[model samples]
Target: MSVPLTVCISAGEPSGDVYAGMLARELLASEPGARIVGMGGREMADSGAELLIDIRDSSVLGLVEVARSLPAFLRKRRTLRDWIRDNRPHVLVTVDFPDFNLGLAAQARSLGVPVVYLIPPKAWAWRRRRGRIVAQVATRVLCLLPFAAGFYRDAGADVEFIGHPLVDTIDAYGLPDRRGAREALGLSDSGRVVGLLPGSRTRELGCLLPPMLDALDVVRESAPDAAAVVALSGSTSDASVAEVTAMATIRGARVVVGSTYEAIRASDAVIAASGTVTLECAIIGTPMVIAYRLSPLTYAVVRRLVRVEHSGLPNLLAGRRACPEYYQSDVSGRFLGSAVTELLVSDAARDSQSGAFSDMRAKLGPPGAMQRAAAIVAETARSWAHE
Candidate 1:
């Protein structure tokens, strides 16, 4: 009797879960007999993977949060390691969540399983020494960023540039027509709209949402006709959503849950927490002000370790400050409001950002990243499993 081809994927956060789902679909489509399973959320399960773990409420953003959640993380790690041992999957695919995924990769390697790391850690930006560790464990790396491929290659890791998955996501979403988007989200067409994007984690809601609302209040002061809309990320808890909704209501901002694309389209400008959402806004050609406030301890540690010139993805991809950024103490209502207000009221400001966005898109490579990554995973499985 022949053994069924097994691919185990581990994605520790919501964004990575979405990516994992896409990859799983591609893998199953190409090889219907392949068994896909591991740790992820609804997306992966819906994509036909039997998830051993559901990653809801497990995302932590910074040093303090990770320290608090260490025990839980350790538990999940142990469970996954056991699964890997029992299954002995042909290939173990690790998606982002570097701190967790990297250790898992090392374990799989010791067990003689070939490991393919998708969207590995950003060692070029911080913890450059970790690049060697990645090179040591990963049999192959599928990178989303062009620069990341170069970085991994230099680290002596086998790497493939599959381009970025967001390009495909946005292209499929289609460019939003402002009037139509406003109608869909029930925002008034007469006034300028500002979207507030806090982030996907519980910690982000506590640390960033209030400041975003404060910025919205500031926008309303300058342009009384302007309306505010807040976008809730997919991974937020029910309690956190309710709290955020109540907070937005107090500030007169309408809360929109899971309608991120619509909110981005409805807005003339946005105040967004620094992360993938900024990159999404840029791809959608929405002008934005990026704000971030890490826990003080995390900020202190990150400030010293981070080697990048820009914190926002748009700025990093554009190789310049395409979006205005305010971090830590500078992430104030006054600063964020001024930047967002300029995009809302000034044609030149909006035009400059939109123009820069086009350049960033060019740098992000073509679509079909999921297909390429899926092919890589299957090839890796065959190469290792047959041997």
Candidate 2:
């Protein structure tokens, strides 16, 4: 009998874990005997990837947060390095978490392991230098955005635009029914509804949720019949969820856990953090206002380094400001509230924003992105066995 195929994936955050989990399941389906193992959270493990380390506790954002977690990063790095040296997995895949994953890719390359980067950093948006660095490190780069693919290809990286995984995720899960979702959230059909998506990371919630809640208060004043629903990410802590629920309850808003898409489907519009969920709302055809804040120091540093004109994914994909975006000091409940109120009450505003969603969806390419990515990853690994 020949040795069974083995692939290792490294995903350091919740969104990356989700995409990595989908890819792991696809890989297992094609090669039943293949062993998929790596560092990630419940998502990857549920998909049959054996966990070498659970990354649930290490999902920090911004430079200051990452610096505080330096010891943990070092530990994870040592563990991954040892695994690659001993197991010599046919392919080592790194998903997002650019700072950690890119370094891991370099280490894997040194150990003679071919590295495939899935959802690599947005070097095209900021830190343009990282584009060339990634080209030098990874054997292959799978990009979600067409523009990112172009940028990486131009930078000399062997790249493929597998399309945005959100399209695949939505297709796989099936979009939630508006009526059913509203009923589940205990929202009335006649009232206007606004969904609140603070973000997936704890730091994101800490920085943004208060302003989002404040915005909900502002909306309630203008549209007394409007209902609010706070959709918490699955990665959020029980304590955080409880606190958020309490806050939402006091403000007369319902809070749901693990029902983000449901809340989006149930709402006329969403007030969201500037992240993947903004794109999710766009795909689901919900008009949204995007806002986010970072630690003051991190914001100051980011302001200098980020070259992109827009922060929201919807805007980035549209190549224009399809959704209203407020950052740092400008991200306030009063501003976000006014934007949500406009989208909720003004048909023209809502129609204009939702119209842009069609163009954004068109750019994400056809579905089956994860299938394409999985095929490439499996082929890259299996071909290495022949070599």
Full-model lDDT for every candidate: 0.88, 0.89
Q: What TM-score against the true fold does each predicted structure earn?
A: 0.97, 0.97
**Which pairs of residues clash in candidate 1, taking residues 3 or more apart in a chain or in different chains?**
none
Error of 2 at 30 (Å): 0.5
List where candidate 1 sits over 4 angstroms from the true fold: 1-3
Q: What lDDT tens digits, residue by residue, belong to model 2 across residues 1-387?
A: 166779999999998999999999998997769899899997999999999999875689988888898898989988998999998999999999987888899999998898999987898878899999999999899999898899999999999999988887787777658888888778887889989899878888888888888887789888887888999888788888988888889887889999899899999999898888988898889999999788989888888898889988889888888889998877888999999899988999988897899999999999899899988997887676678
lDDT of 1 by residue, 1-387 (tens): 056678999998988998999999999898768899899987898999989999987788887778888898888888888999997888999999988989999999999999999999989899998788899999999998888889999999999999888899888986569998899888888888999998888878888787787887678788988889999876678898899988889788898887899899889899998888888898888899998899999999999999999988899888888889999889888888888988888899999998999998888889899999988888888888778
> By lDDT, who's the top model here?
2
Q: lDDT score, residue 272, model 1? A: 90
What TM-score does candidate 2 reach?
0.97
lDDT at residue 67 of model 1 (Cα atoms): 81
Would you give me the overall lDDT of model 1?
0.88
